[model samples]
Target chain A: MEKVVLGNHAVSYGVLVSRVQTISAYPITPQTLIVERLSEMVADGELDAIFTKVESEHSALASAIGSSSVGARAFTATSSQGLALMHEMIHWASGARLPIVLANVNRAMAPGWNIWTDQNDSLSCRDTGWMQIYCQNNQEVLDSIIMGYKVSEQVLLPTMVCLDAFVLSHTAENVDIPEVKLVDKYLPPYKLEIKMDIDDPHSFGALSSPENYMEFRYKMQEAMDKAEDIIIKEGKEFEKIFGRKYGMVEEYRTEGAEIILVATATIASTAKASIDSLRAKGINIGLLRLRVFRPFPVKDVVRVLLNKKKAIVIDRNISYGKSGIFFDEIKGAFYNIEGDKPKIFGYIAGLGGRDVTPEAISDMVDDAMRKDKPEKDIIWSGVKL
Target chain B: MIEILIHGRGGQGGVKASLSLASAAAKAGKHVQSFPEFGVERRGAPVKAFNRISDEPIVIRSKIYNPDHVVVLDPTLIQSINITEGLKKGGWIIINTDKNPGDFKEFCKNYKVATINAKEIALRNRLGSRAAPIVNTAILGAVIKVLKVSDKESLAIAIKEFVPVKREENVKAAYEAYDEVVFEGEV
Candidate 1:
């Protein structure tokens, strides 16, 4: 049925529809509502799942890993600091190839203890081998969760769908939640091809020597490589059942445009508006919204921007002393391509919970279009003393 | 396009005000985006939230710098914060205080100002004391009446969606504040 709901509640609903067997979490601002709703669902017997109220974010993920190891479809959630605390467990979850799904309400990490939305928290874990999908609105936040689970289970990799903390989390929007019957029809119960068997009593997380470690690592790479196809297949199946199909990347008005802008999260919504506004003004601008971050859709991005003369990337999170996080990834993808690479301009904006208005984005696009020389560098937008 | 910034304490429904404004605008078939900038890192701290409403979807993710309208839930916050910085020319200001618009104009110039005792109206409407500071529902009435952009049905749907259970009280508070808030005259 269709109802108006907040973004965080949509994630909780996604968990419910996905039939998650084990759930765990610790309360954090912006993200607290998600766990609260899940807890209420568990208590009211609406969602039949083993709910684990853990003490720390570490334990929340560790508990999920434990549950998944025993062959149960598990779920958990957290934000900036909570996600930071679960860093070690993230590696553990991914390395073990468990198809667990986590919803991270993106928030600014603090020395000042701010709880506003930003992307740095999740971007810091880019190398953790977890398939991450950043959402643009309430519907994407909900749909991505279900899709993340379906994709993760196929590849045996943990997945995280990132939503801007307060932007999507606390804000309410009209969302159409499919019936449980539809969800069930789309997502069958978790069936494992390989799992720890208590009766067989096999060793798990054993020490690896150099001779065998490479083979295991190669196998994990194979799983990640296989994820691309599985994600597309399941996304198609999802469309058939739920009437919504999401690709690793979505192009908005990029055809015949000279400039392309890439972004994730609610920022994509803003970019879309800017694109539409500029289009009406006779500006040749388009947008590419990245749905999947990990197993980064390198080829798709590279192919999409090949003919575009200029590409502007707005990064909400900074990677400390280095360039914008996604800029580096996108550039790396174009390094070996045989065509003229689009001149890439990176803007670091909206960090530490700063607002990103349409005017600001318009200015950024105009600046990128004005570049006299094509070079690789990053610029900070809306930065003040 | 109209940008609205709301200043209030964490418990005063400052966030609720922005969401309600967004709901009202969305119901008018306007593209709208609303978000709270304040973190619940501490209670009773001066908190702010924002709303952007236009006929088209918004793309700028920046916080509202100069708002077309500013709503202050508490009069005391005026001293604690600028409360007027970045206010657009001829912008509208809505202040919920016992002090009428004349007293508020002493601190505000270069714009249109509206003042009303929303807390008193809320209390009289049986919205209770806790929600007294959150005159957003009442303030929304004044905003819609002054802006003349939102349909009455849109305001009704917004109130219903935001204050569903206390429909009567919310509607009463809205009407009371709408009556008292002076757009170009004495309260």
Candidate 2:
């Protein structure tokens, strides 16, 4: 059904249609609505599932991990401090190969206590071996959840569908939720090849020693590498069933553009609006929205953006002393390839829920268009003391 | 862009109200952006949110220092906080208060104002007037009438999206407020 929905509600609807068997969550800002809606769905008999009211965000993931380990599709959500609290379990979920799907609403880390939109909360989890996909709107939030389940189950890995805290989270937009029958056809109930059995009991989460730790790590990397193909396949199949198609990345108005902005989530929407406004004024610019961040889409990056003379990465989350993480990854992707890697400049904006105004994006482009940027690595946009 | 500031407490459907307004305005062929700013992420604290609606894409990204219109969801917040700090001249102020418009005229100087007994409407409709949170829908109706930007039909569509079962009550509350509340100038 087509309706105006918030980002959090979209995730709830996505999980509901995907028929997630288990939902575990602890209340947290920007993410509380997701579980709240899910709980309502359960109470109203709209969905038949186990809704576990956990104590902390750690327990939320732990509960989902337990369900997934028992061979059931499980789900959870959190943001900022809650996500940071679940940091230890993040590695556990992925390391155990549990195929749990989580909706991570991005928020700023606290020293000053802020509840706004930014990617820092999710970006900090990029190394946790979870396939991270950022969304641009409520519809994407819903679609990505369905896609996350398919991608995760195929590779036996966890996935995080990230949407900016308030930009997409609280913002309302028209979202076309897939029908129950259609989603059921596209995503059948998950069937695991491995499960815990009393007759043949096996210990999970066992400590790894130096002799075997490297091999375990390599196997995990290999599984993530295989996920790219599985994701592409599932996406194509899903597109065939539904009318919408999702690629590793979505390029918007990028052809024959002189300058480009690499964005994710709501920034991609804003950049598109800016692209339209700028195009009317005769400026040739474009946008490339990075949908699948982890298991980084190297080929798509090269094919879509490497040829551009100048490209700017608008990072809503920064790596502090280091440059923007995606910029670093993109640089590494192009390191071995011949020819000039697009002069990728990184700009950090919308930190601590600060607004990433169209003017701010324009300023970032104006600075990146220059030959010499004062800061070679990460640039700050619209920061005030 | 028509910027509106909504003043309320944490649990008073303030976020819901902003979204309803945005969606309603969007349905009227406008681009909208709604956002909330707050300190305490709890149930009862002075909270404020903004919605920017325009025919074109919204580009302004600052807190609405000067709102073209204001919706006071909670009457107490007016005394606790300065709700009129950034109200633009000639702007409209919609207050969900039991007091008469004449009683608030002194406070709402330099701007057009309307006052409604939203709690009464909520009670009459058996919606339970515990702080009268649903008054936002009622205010939206009056806003549509006063602003002339959105029609009652569009406001009805927006309200239905949020509060479906209580559609008649909400629409009635909105119409009652529209009839009783006095805008500064006749429209």
Candidate 3:
């Protein structure tokens, strides 16, 4: 059914349709509405699940980890400070190879106490062995959560569905919620081959010697590598049922384009508008919306961007001494590519909920198109300094 | 595309009003998007919410700078906020004030101004407590009346969908404001 709902509520409905067995979450700004709606659903008997109200984010993910280890589909959500609190549990959940799905509303990290949108919260956890998928709108939030569960269960790796804090989380848009039977067919009951079983006792995350520890890390990497294909497969299956297709990366108007703008989350929507306006003026420009950040779609990124003359990456999070986190990733991805490649420009913008307007994006495009090579690797767009 | 900026206090349902307006536009077969500019969320803090209604899908997710219309849910907010900061030329400002349009002649110099005694309407309909009247729905009604984008019936359906309690009161308040809203030229 089509309903005008907030992006956070869409996450709740996604968890509902996925038939999550256990929900463990602590309230945080932006992300609070998601779990609040879930608790209401559980209390109203609309969703038959165990809603565990934990004291902190650490306990929240810990509870989800416990539930998933017991072979139940578990879900949780958190934002910037809350996610930072759950940092250790995040690695533990992934290291244990639990198929847990989490919705992280991306908020800016702060000493001055900001609760607005940024990518630092989720992107900072890149070293953790979890797959991350960013969403652009309310519909994508719902669809990606459903797909995150399917992909996570298949690959046995935790998944984080990230959306911009207020840009997507608090925004309301028309979303077509899938029927129960259809979603059931797409994401059936999760059955695990390895779980905490009383009948067959075995230690899951016991102490591993250095000789065996390397192999375990390798195996986790292997599973993350395997998730890319599973994510694509699940996305295709979801599209067949719901008529909305998703992928690790979405290429928009890239054909015969001279300049390409790379962005993720809600920023991609603004980039699309910039592309539309730029294209109208007879400029050869395109947009590459990076949906999935982990198990980074290296081959797809190379395939789409290898031929472009110039590419600019717009990142909402900074890596401090380094450039934007995504810009660093994209640059590192292209380092080993043989032959000529696009002159990649990295831009940092929209931090702490600063609006990345279409005009700013268009100016970035113009600057990128003019320069044959960037004087500096990273340019902080729209900042006064 | 028609962009609208709604100004209200934190607890006055500005965000809810924008959502209802977006929902009404969507129900009328137009694409719409609505979001609130969230700060340190607290009751009675100055808040702003935005809505975009268009025939085509809205691809720009930036904060509305040059809005085609502005809806002031609380008349007192006009004293503090530059409510007409980025209002487009020939745009309209629908305010929930008992004051006459001529009273805001300097403020309404660049835009069309419309007013409605929404607090009186909310009191008559008993939408909220007698001390704090819920004028969001009534202001929403004035917005629709000034813009003529969506009908009263469509907005009524949206109010029913969003307002959990006092649906009848909100719907009645909306229609009452729609009927009694005084435009600058009309007065």
Chain A TM-scores for all candidates read 0.98, 0.96, 0.99
Clashing pairs in 2: none
Estimate the lDDT of model 1: 0.83
* Cα lDDT of model 1 by residue, A1-385, tens digit: 6555778999999999999999997999879999999999999999999999999999999999999998899999999999999999999999999999999999999987778888889988988889889988788888888888888888889999999877789766556788888888878889876678877788889999998988977877888888888888888998898888788898999988888999888788878878989999999888998888888898789878997888899998888777888887888899888988788888988887777878888999888877864465679898986
How should the candidates be ordered by lDDT, best one leading? Answer: 3, 1, 2
Fnat score for model 2? 0.18
Pick the winner on TM-score between candidates 1 and 2.
Answer: 1
Which one wins by lDDT: 1 or 3?
3
Off by over 4 Å in 2: A199-215, A373-375, B1-3, B8-13, B22-34, B38-46, B52-134, B146-167, B178-187
Residue by residue across B1-187, what tens digits does model 2's lDDT show? 7888989888777887787877788778777777777335477887887888888755344456789988898898877988888889878888888776678766556877887777777777766556444677777766777776677777778877777578888878777766776665675
Candidate 3: segments with Cα more than 4 A from true spot: B100-103, B184-187
How do these models rank on DockQ, best leading?
3, 1, 2
Best by DockQ: 3
TM-score of the second chain for every model: 0.89, 0.88, 0.95
Candidate 1: residue A96 Cα off by (Å): 1.9
Across residues A276-362, which tens digit of lDDT does each residue of candidate 3 receive?
A: 889999999889999999989898888878878888999999988889988888888899899669889999999999989999999
What C-alpha lDDT values do all the predictions have?
0.83, 0.82, 0.90
RMSD list, candidates in order:
3.7, 4.0, 1.8
